[model samples]
Target: MIITRCLRPSFLAKPRLPPLSGCRQFWGWLNAVFNRVDYERIKDVGPDRAASEWLLRCGAKVRYEGFDKWQYDYNGLPTGPLGKYKIQAIDATESCIMSRGFDHLDGLEHLEELKLCQCIYIEDTCLERISKTDNLQKSLRRLEIISCGNVTDKGVISLHSLRNLEFLLLRDLPGIQKKEMILELLQKSIPPLQIELDLKD
Candidate 1:
């Protein structure tokens, strides 16, 4: 926000001040030059805004908190902050995070780690949506689905497309009855995924 004043004595002879006219021109030029850049950091309003804000307030330099569409890729690693302040991880443990709510996930392209611990609302369909995220295929490295009672083998298998995943934690999930399918596909995979499972009865 810059304010500039121009003085034009000759134009002041008329009813309107020529100085004000020049000031308006300068303001217009300023807007034209920087209209595209986001000068003010906006605090977005959304369901996940609280979560994102919590992270930021706790010294997490996160710019966006999600529940939108997969606009960016799951970037960075387990804990290190990335180049951009985009969402790098999601912790929906015991939260209201659900399967149908994944429409918002499409916007979280920079998400890397996702924790759905005790999220009873999520199901295999959520994994289906996760698999579709372009960034998940390239950037997502860690996925944790613990005690999500609705997820099954089919849903767990849906994550097979996340090729870059390095760690997968599935514990206390009674929904995933057949663990072999998941283990066979990911445990000894090309990237050698590190996994933790407790599907046994």
Candidate 2:
């Protein structure tokens, strides 16, 4: 009697994926959680505090009104009165903030400066959302978008909605062509808005 051993078919074997594949998925989920907007939380704590929690959780830094130091550490955030710490500036360098989470910017009445650097997920829609935010359009003055590859002239031009914007800085945005034309258009739309660009000619 000859006994034959059944061999597993190669097609049934699992393909090797990158070792960090699971890590990538974990990070993606974590970022989503961090970016989640709790409208109730916003109402209960006010937009500044709620937005502070979101930004800090997503690895961004925020400076509150009348504060010279940036608040970055998630655990070390101020325990002072919630409404007292109105967010005045946001520096989201290398942070995971995406357009879906920008509802936090909706009611920021005092936000004057914003910096988005190396924010891999930022795109035209993100800028569009910012442009359309009523409070931001009225109060935001200084803006910086650096090393965010997805931003293009369309996104940059959407800043026209920010009627009060005073300054804009663009650097290393490979997606922006006709840099000169974009500059001209932005200056024309917002006459008081000064712009600085480091995009390659």
Candidate 3:
């Protein structure tokens, strides 16, 4: 009697991966796709709509102008009139938004409040970009940045451009050095702005 064993070919065998590796890869790919900026789509749907789509796709929530309920689901996005529904507030906690996608916020004249929490991709350049935006500088009122480790004093100080900003809240930002000095500068630059911080020296 001859014993024969069947062995799977190396090429056909599945590669071993660490726990949640596949899931991580999938999420990374999805985030990359969500962050992609399509200029044609922006021109077609308008900046608010395009920005809303991007925010929703990246696990962020948006509150439309005059709407109390937040729009979080990508599939359930409001569809009535393109320019009618303007973005009023954005909650981009743990979202995949990067500096490249900042262009989507250019023409959002009604945007009032923006919260960025645990957004690992946010950096000084991103803050500088939004701070310099003419529309955001005029319209934005409240801004909250929490646990965004990449934000530093340079980025925080650049927010002085938001001349109309009424409130600023910052928490758990390890990158921000000279928090007291930054706060003083902010106070001097924007006299009416109120800032709240939970930072360590």
Model 1, span 1-201: residue lDDT tens: 999988779866658557987998785454333222221222243323333433322223233434343322223212323323367676665554544445444445666777777765578888888888786688788888888888888888888888889889888888777787678877555357888886658
- In the range 1-201, model 2's lDDT, one tens digit per residue, is 999999889999888876798888888888888889999999999899899989999999999889899999989888877688889999999999988799999889999999999999899999999999999989999999999999988999899888899999999999999787888888888999889999965
Q: What is the lDDT for 25 in model 3?
A: 83
TM-score per candidate: 0.58, 0.88, 0.88
lDDT of 2 at 97: 98
**Each prediction's Cα lDDT score?**
0.62, 0.92, 0.92
- Candidate 1 local lDDT, residue 86: 65
Model 3 clash pairs are none
lDDT tens string, model 3, 1-201?
999999999999999776798888887777777888899999999999999999998889999988899999999988887798999999999999988889899989999999999998899999999999999999999999999999998999899899999999999999998887998989999999999999866
Clashes per candidate (backbone, < 3 Å): 15, 0, 0
Candidate 2, residue 96: lDDT: 98
Candidate 3 Cα outliers beyond 4 Å, as residue runs: 1-14, 18-30
